[model samples]
Target: MAPQTSETEQVVDLNSWLPITASRKAKWWYSAFHNVTAMVGAGVLGLPFALSQLGWIPGIVAILGSWLITFYTLWQLVELHEAVPGKRFDRYPELGEHAFGPKLGYWIVMPQQTCVQVASTIVYSVTGGKSLKNYSMVAFIASTIRGSHHHPATYGVRSHTTAGQIFDVLNGIGTIAFAYAGHSVVLEIQATIPSTQKNTSKKPMWKGCVVAYIIVALCYLAVSISGFWAFGNVFAMPVFDMLESCLVQKLHFTPGRALRFAGRSTYVAITGFIALCIPFFGGLLGFFGGLVFASTSYFTPCIIWLVLKKPNRWSFHWIASWISIIIGVLIAVLAPIGGIRQIIISAKTYKFFS
Candidate 1:
């Protein structure tokens, strides 16, 4: 029989598990750029639609609130790495294993992490494809207008009587939560920053996080706030869709003869062919944020912290942890249900090419 090892004696061999035998040496700036790109993508574009659903005040609060919660949870993961003496956790699932038994780590955290990754790839692909298609379509419209028509494609704001209600708030929360979905890579990025006397790896991680998230917040605010200002509630959840819809509505859905051929060949093949999954982008973001992000970002870290640290019950730390857990659970439960409901309600009017 194999001998048992104490927590302090547990050693993970990176070469045995990881494909890369050695960590790639990189400057903190490079790693910071990687983190920023990973975190900020198509999701930034959708923030305005979220703001449309959430009122301005609530939308601002949600962005700030989620950012703080996300940063705190990220820091918790860092602390978890230091939990076992003389050992460091390089991955989220590994930390889960360290905190709980292998079952929770492999079964819960791993799957959630995988789902988050796969969903993110889908969002990126759809966004990229649609972006390309929109560019081509706009070019086609411009040429057609110059040749056969006089008026340029123009769009106007469509307003709602109310900013939003409970369902809208939930949807906005889910979408905003999804915007901060790079937690899975935080530890790995932290590991690549070579430690120095004045600057430990944690220093770079903290610096990277602060810089990246500030960019994220500003980018998100610019899109959501400006979008709401321009389009109001008339925009689609996926902001790309909102933009395309603006042009389509202005063009009255029938492309000029010259535009139709190009639209049918390129636009249809690129955007329309992929749009069922694409328009669902916003809903998927909401679903993923609630189903995975809340659990991984909010609930898991707090639970792991309490479990490993064993903070005293009814104390300030304990009470705060419990509150976080409850909020995470509530968002997880409410957001998905509301998101799916919104998707279904909107599907009746959904069009592939429009």
Candidate 2:
């Protein structure tokens, strides 16, 4: 039999289709918007709060350091996506599977990626609900004032105990981690762009990503600086695709509108309920960032790059990878300590569905 062409291979199959890999007609600008949107969501708003906890120097270091590290890791992921000719690792776990053994990589990466998506949905839900509520209060105040009113903005005031300050710094690191949580879906976003043998997807995807990161830097710089001075904040629908893929591809269920509607709606309802239960997630930024986002966005790519590239000893890539991993692991461990503490504190006063 003759080798099938890439065109013959890419024919859409609804039965085995997943949302993230379904669309392959996006232009470079689509990636710019998608990445910008993915990278600048609920977490961006928390950066100010994150900066406040870390103090001036440490916080600046953390922000600039994270930006640089994440950018490098992102480049590594893009290069690896098409390292093998004619094959693409669309999902993060797929890349992990390539670097490590399939089962081991899946186990190592899947949990972290899944957690990032699930936790993000919960955070977004809380942020969305509170935003409207806050807007209403502002609107009411405006009505009474009859014009624009400037209120004193209190940011970065340190009044916590010694231990509390420590926890806050750790939490702040997690918040910073949260802000750069874009790695999980980089390949997924790139997958949308059309790739050819002559012109691979990475070229266009990287171009767009560069733009997105630029926007991220501009927004974060002002937000983070002003917040500390002032304060500071993905997947292309991974949760939906993951669930549908499991049902349709893993379990051999038929893929159709009904299944999608039911599954997607259930996911929404669950995330909403969790959001309602918490009602406030300001403290969760660090917890989720450290617990899972760091693994998915910060260190996982670095580890995979080291495994696959095997850069020479003490080389630039090698040293940078190690440094990133070290910091990422610390953030994963220490940031979550404060996050869990914050959760416990919040839980004590939190009311169910109130």
Candidate 3:
């Protein structure tokens, strides 16, 4: 008979059980791919349209500024991942808990994190479905529907009303916020890389992130310059995939292939149905971006950093953090107003599943 280890002695290996956390042997290039996917997915396509709304200067500044600020914030997050010599904060919530009180931090971070992931999924569902629909329809059918002599695409803001132009600008901010929001997944992605005292995960993670940011800068510049174009929840697909595996495997709550399959399929169906109902990913990007993305990407980390690191008051880092916070707060406030207005306008002319 085999001897059993006591509960206290039973140290389960999470990497072996969970689908998301199981494989921690990923190399630097793997991080590059993940970062690229997280940063440059459907979000980039929306930039041109966002550019149209903001016009050349604000749009350009938004893209360039976001690139810099997010990168800086990303670095802060990477540093915080293993801030405690022997410990790792594997998730955003964990980091939040460490910075804020356990209860306060969880409440503050989890809702924003969940909203970003879930809202991203819902937005992506709409985008993917629309893409498939556009591709599947015959060229003749598409031309017939779109009209043989539709107005040529223009870069000017499409808003005619004073109120609409204001809304458009607000939505534009949200779109930019949404486009630059990869910070939420940084720690999670870093967690996949094996770390040692001599060689920490941050080095490779930062390297991969640098590569991804370069690609993002190039792609975004091109996309924003070209004629206005393209959701986005599709970008959040990885987050969704990870969530299921984590729940079943790490949580030890009925872990099985069946559970994974059933959970994922149900998730797909629900998101799809909602997409069909809304089918306005473009407009909603602003809402999602402002609603949660700003919190996750912009101010949340700054807040967390200030709380945990206590950077010197009136210093460069301190001033920059405040600037980020102010910007984030404005986005959170105005982006939703713009997005909701956009939704109302779209709904007036929209058909479900169309």
Candidate 4:
């Protein structure tokens, strides 16, 4: 048998194992976009309905609270980055380990990360499905209006008359799928940024964070306004509210073609957009895989590395992707759409505590 590796060698190996990879680096923009998208996506889509339920002041307050939480979390992440110059914020568990003891860091952060991943996934899947159904209904309505006196094609597309239970399920599944796709993007971002030997100035990074926050805030606000105005007391998803808003007005140039073929085509196109997002479901699965890497693969191993001060060739990165895929598949099969929705929405409430 070969001589046993030294403890020093093991620590080096572990450090190398956790080093940010290339794939994450290459797709930084997409990852950043995913961050923003996941944060605001379903929230915006359902803001109008939520606003109607809670009223404007309450809605605004909730959104403001969300923004405050986002700012605080992001600030903490930045501080972590500053504290450890070379480490990536995506590897939050490592940062925690460094600041707190290894056990404390792992115990505190790992579970939180897991909760975030699972909850975000559920929200994405559920909202995505609801958005799809809403757009489908819009398309159906437009089609009927256009083909009223002409050739009526029996597409069999009906409005969503499903019970509350079914609606909840589909929404949750869609939300999870959305969150999963989002997590994958974060891994890609974490891998891409070059690991610096010394701490860099936080100005540029902070600027990016500020811009992102503002954009997210505005988007959420717009969706909330548009959704509530359109739905007017109907507790529908924000996407449905937006569609309803869009349908109310006629074209300035073509007054006679209010509900014409062109209008129907536009509605269909919107529905198609939602349909195309089905691929994102797969993306979400990949993201959850990345989270598994961060949690089981990255966080746990890093803790061991800290204590052992040695590196192991076996790293969490290797199996993280596959593990995520498996979990996602199992969830897809076993949970059903409703279960997914419940998980996602329930997770959303955690934002209050986060």
Candidate 5:
């Protein structure tokens, strides 16, 4: 006889269609590594510029706040996965389908996923292009400092006006959100942890979160603080301007105007090819993080939790979840304005080869 089905149950046939599966042999630490790897990618490179926009103190606060918010929401996702009996979702979209209906899941996750991938690709392309050119790190660092000398207006604090500071802080929020937007990896890694009966005190998943964030925090602080210290307010989005300027300074073999023009043309062509569709790496990161990741990392989880638990309207958790959702929405709305403004400002002085 065929197995019976409960009327309340929602069927998800993902196992047959999806290639990913839980690995029984994997431990929690391994899962944590996956989480760390997922969250800590090319996004770190943009942190310096992000810091510049937000200011040192405000930037650190924002980073910590975002981390805590993201971490709490991630824990909600974990708890949601274990809420029902005999039901497990291997993918984020799968969890969405189970929480809502299949159709809502499809619409919500599809665009968000596309944006994340697109943003990540842009970040990688910019980083890779710079790396391939083999720019001297020391020269780049020095030039970054010196670049501030020529553009003093661009390098230091522009205004103490409330609106100006708000805009500046908003400009960096997208990059902050982007750097910490790897919730999908957490779900994947959690799936791999083998349930243990001998000791249940420390959940491997939680331990992994702890470890991963420590590493992520260190990396983010190091890169961001260093970048801001080196270039201050004049820090470029992709940050390759420093490297390019350094390279140009060292090039004593410029063989006349024709050769230089040819070289510049070739450099532009190469960058154009590598940059793919997006020319402004930092702006794209901010836009994508705000438009897509805010929902996936913060808003969606809170919504899902609210739906699943159906807490009292005035309860603490309910209020907290709503607050998070509101913050996410605000970030989604406000971040793009700052990103677009930054892009427009950048365009006024943008050079193809530099």
Candidate 6:
């Protein structure tokens, strides 16, 4: 026998079908953090590649385009929030169904959303891995400097070393993983906000959106400015720019003892940094979880709901999702990792102002 829907389930389902919902004030900070994290991560991972492939002008253009896209998305969400104050944007599919008919609604949004999630997941995984390696290397260098009391002529920072290339690949994987990992928060947001709780106050949700955007923008600008200033012409990656600029090398103390001490210190520092990064890598794992959630929890359920409740027709959502997933997996498996990196750089150039 089919399981019966409880009152809570019924309420959740109803809420899930609405267009927008009021978010908690406390969650505003969380949203700000999320936006900042995403923007910085993207900039650090994307900027160097973009600059190398498309030149500086194109790279700047791409950044601008990405910003504009983000702005438009936020605007739409705010408008939807205003229209249906008690629901979330995820429920917009249902609203589309109500307005444009089920078939049209599913076709309009699901495929685009799925693609965005997939792209996001890949970027997160790749970038996260790179950040891990970059930070680890930084710790290693710092330790070495401290150990060698006989100040080395150079702090050993190089632009396009083999080590940098390896880190770049790792960063790409981390970016993908990070993008795919974290959906529990999104799920929690959907679950906790009641359908009946509308924002009756005229205080625009856009205020919160603007605050979140500004926080993110500042973080991006800081990292970008710091990176460019430090690396100048030699900056090969966003993380590299930050590292080159943010760290300072100093020489003090007796040579022999300092050398020994610095070596040990570097070792400890490098190890600790790597250890700390394991949790950040957890974000990549969360991205995989997000992919599963997007596929099974989101797209699948939506398809099933449409099939059962309204129309009984095969649709593009299923076809496009499967195709995209297949293509993504094939690309992940078959494409040379370097090739993928190049493609990402090229695509960023083509799509954005870059």
Model 6 quality (TM-score): 0.43
Clashing pairs in 5: none
By lDDT, the best candidate is 2
lDDT for 180 in candidate 1 is 80
| Cα RMSD, each candidate | 13.8, 4.8, 5.0, 19.1, 13.3, 17.8
Q: Across residues 149-219, which tens digit of lDDT does each residue of candidate 6 receive?
A: 44333222223667445434433332222222222123222222323444432233344446656665554
Ranking by TM-score: 2, 3, 5, 1, 4, 6
lDDT of 5 by residue, 1-354 (tens): 988765333122222212234144567688578767777776676677788878778888878888888888877877765556655654566677777889997567645654554456556676666555322243345545666664444445434778766666676898788887776445555665655444331377778777888887777776676567666660111112212322344563332455445554565555456575445667766776777778878788898888889999989889879988999999999887777766666667655444
For residue 230, model 4's alpha carbon misses the true position, in angstroms, by 1.0
> How high a TM-score does candidate 4 get?
0.46
lDDT of 2: 0.80
Please give, for residues 1-354, the per-residue lDDT of candidate 4 as tens digits.
Answer: 989988777544433432233133333344345456545444345444444434566556755653543354354344445454454544545555665678997466555454444434443554455445443234334434444545433222111435543433333332223222222223223334444555343434454556666766766666555445443440112122223323443322221244444554564455445434432332233233233322332233333333333323445523432343344344344334443343354454433212
Pick the winner on lDDT between candidates 2 and 6: 2
* Candidate 1: Cα lDDT at 58: 77
Count the clashes in each prediction.
1, 10, 4, 36, 0, 53
TM-score of each: 0.71, 0.88, 0.86, 0.46, 0.72, 0.43
Model 1 residue 18 CA deviation (Å) reads: 3.7
Q: Tell me how far candidate 4 lies from the true structure as C-alpha RMSD in angstroms.
A: 19.1
lDDT for position 3 in model 1 = 97
Misplaced by over 4 Å in model 3 are 1-11, 133-155, 229-252
- Candidate 3 TM-score to native: 0.86
Report the number of the highest-TM-score candidate: 2
Clashing pairs in 3: 120-233, 123-233, 124-233, 124-234
